[model samples]
Target chain A: MKNSPTKNQISSYIIQSQEEEIKRIALELHEGVGQTLYSLYSGLQFIEQTINSSNMKSYVNEMSQLLEKTIQEIRLLSVELHPPTLTTLGLVPAMKSYLRMFTSTYGILVDLDIEGQEPNLTETQKITLFRVCQEALGNVAKYADTHFIQLDFLFVDNNLTMTINDNGKGFTVENEMQRSSGLAAMKERMNLIGGQCLITSEIGKGTTIDVLLPL
Target chain B: MVMDNLYNQTYMKQACEQLQGTIECDFVGLAFQESKGPNIGWKYASGNSNDKYERITLRYGKGIAGRVLSTGRPMEIKYFPQNILGKALEYPIMLAEKLLYAYAVPILINGIPKGVLLVGFRSETSISDDEKKFVEKAAADIKKFLSLEKM
Candidate 1:
């Protein structure tokens, strides 16, 4: 308590504290709420197996639908807290899963192109790249009014490059950065791993975000 | 609630207006997620004339909308033909839409990307750093709400 100052230092400490708190809540959602939901889902499945009636099955199906939705919500909450895929599987798999989910949810076509061989990246690098792409995709969903978006990954030698391009109502890049923090956050996250992020776009055209990292 | 409907419309409207206001450009639209993807690219003409941009189906990586739909990221550019790569010019959303300067961002959730949010300026005004930050923040906020709705 004594170490926490009210001005710059305390503010940073408070922010850190806040992030930790969010993480804790996320963890709780995973451990407590997620488990409870999973239990409920399993119990419903058991009941679904025991009962046999075509008409009753239809009603059960409705209940199952609601349960499925609840399960999906719980899964999303857990993922939002801390993605297990990122921890167990690596960034590539996590990204692929995320892309598939994106296409299904938004009814958008996602063309994912992976070029060259992908080497094993450090956990830090993988997480950094994942977060950068995550944020980049976030921008696209919230902003780009386009039907198609492409995420391209190229690994040439020791350098890795990721390009996210979209064709929507394009705005001035300068003004976007001034008004929006998503781009800056993406750049900052990439910069942490000694990478660079670039954005290019046009009006009535589209926008593209390029991120480069050294392997 | 009236506020809820108003809020939704306002949100959609503001998304278009922000693009119009920031870039000092005309023509704003929103292509939401449809069963068959963003169908019939509706030119959200809150500020511009409702002339000819209503009947369009955007493909992935072909036009401006298609590219954003495919990539799930933000974009910005000044000169269209001069700056656009020649080989990737088959898409008509850019030229057909008549966008000059442009910026777009993806609305994402839980480390996943959904749809895209876009803004455009018909002129060659340089997009500053601050503008990008604001757009990104707005996109994130919107995505959060969308995710909540999903839940």
Candidate 2:
């Protein structure tokens, strides 16, 4: 499945497929790998308790440590595969939870202003939009050197709108076109929704992003 | 592993530089999360000229940025000042930034928006389909790198 594309198409196809595959593998890691590993650990613990060979005990202890590390990695993998929050609480709430973590982890204040009752969006819509926002914020956290950030949402008149603004160094859109894929993906999501995306910035003023989606 | 505040500092600054080249606009950045936790909405700039945008925190559905964040989508305004109602006092960031034509993209993690990415052209620059593609690609790529999916 990974090697069927033409040369020019291979990279993009591989990346897309890889991401999808990773999601699948991550899920398997959670549901199957995780359970198997835990069961093994439990079995080993029982063995360690019942049979008291000193050498065997030491070997089992070492294996237990290794298993513990694997378990942690698997958990991480599972989260990556499909964020539990995304499934449990829908897109908006999931982002709220993520923002809490992002704010604390990065020490960046991300003020959220979401208005209008949310209409149920398809899972794909939610994921696509979520992915785009994740990328944009990552750039802000990595590049936008400002102390205040605003995230606003509006669901009015059957149109879904979003905006992100920051007081940081601004750039030229033409120049940005030459570098980076983050912006590209954002636009794709908007287009998929038959929506529009716009970006504005200045040398020392700030940056603002606005998006509108047909509900 | 815990990523220190230094990481945020570095990235925010880097984002400004990157935007300058990528967007061909100017200023960049916004507020950073404080050590104590989330704070009220505010606008903070680290690149270009910082003026009106720094004054107030936008409520959801207000202003260009607010609209995008609130809806969790993207917006394109070929003639920003002309298209929007009132002036900078009403649209402070747009007025201060002197953005005549602007476009914004919402950054969402999980299902909600975490931030926004904006690019503007001075005077009367109409957003092209190609340019829109660029913004979307950049937005998604950045999210993937940030591991927002994990969040």
Candidate 3:
């Protein structure tokens, strides 16, 4: 092949391109679809207050409730496509806010412990870590049997380390690779930044994901 | 109330159902002004056999809806006469739906026509003056239903 790139290079390029597209679509959803929905809701409120029939009022009330839920869904979708704070606030605050959403939606409790000081990280590195964390938490919510999760961070020897542990019915790594692309995507995100990801799991036990990032 | 996709669909379905009972027509449809286009097409229709009406776009003075929308007036054809239309090629929806007679009520907001509500019958029949009044009132009510946007 002429000017051939490695498979890893192609995959990293794909990820970076996808992130850029996500930002564009997220803004469109928030501004276009989201605004139209807001206008509809406001329209319903006017009808509800002006109407005198109890039966019609009830019908209006039901539709208004549905609209409110829809507006929230769009807002959530826009935020998930690209978190606005991820770039400006850096990794920790972004992850912290993300974890709040993640736990509230999944109804799981996460105990996060930070050690040492926050290390200097490239924007790419920070985003990679955030994606890795996102993937790990998604896996936990999907497969974990336990309600509790543990997240630990460390900085030592010019390396930044993070672990995500879940008390879930751990699947065989080989079997999981065949079943889902989640782990592969996580590994790809880590590999793009020269980070190391170690996923350890055993049947009837919990799963642990440890990531080491050279600072 | 913020309109979401699902909620919008549900609201339209409900409105169409209510229109059927009030207008007592075989078909009930709503068409809104296209945000970027000068033409309008049926956006929602219930009691429709297929989506033919929704697909036909209408320009001002082009179809029955076009005339009503432009004039901000309600119109009705009591009989489905072959020669009632000015031109055969002008009304694609009439041919598509095979509507014998129909009524169009201009959904006006601030005396400006923003949309049109169309109801039709399959066969030639008279739309009573009383029934016509009801359809006109429904158009006014729809405006009130949309007034919350200003708030």
Cα-based TM-score, every candidate: 0.52, 0.46, 0.52
Off by over 4 Å in 3: A1-3, A116-123, A155-158, A174-180, B1-151
Cα displacement (angstroms), candidate 2, residue A127, comes to 1.6
**lDDT tens digits by residue: candidate 2, A119-185:** 8887666766676677777667556666578999899999888888888787777688568677766
Q: Which segments of candidate 1 are over 4 A away from where they belong?
A: A1-32, A48-61, B1-151
True-contact fraction per candidate equals 0.00, 0.00, 0.00
Q: What TM-score does each model's chain B reach against the true chain B?
A: 0.73, 0.73, 0.87
Per-residue CA lDDT of candidate 1, range B22-96, in tens? 645565566554434123254344454423344444444444555665566677666765666442233333443
Rank by lDDT, highest first: 3, 1, 2
Model 3, DockQ value? 0.01
Q: Rate the local accuracy (lDDT) of all candidates.
A: 0.64, 0.62, 0.73
**Model 3: how far is B68 from its true place, Å?**
40
lDDT of 2: 0.62
Instruction: Give the fraction of native contacts in model 3.
Output: 0.00
RMSD of each: 15.5, 18.7, 17.4
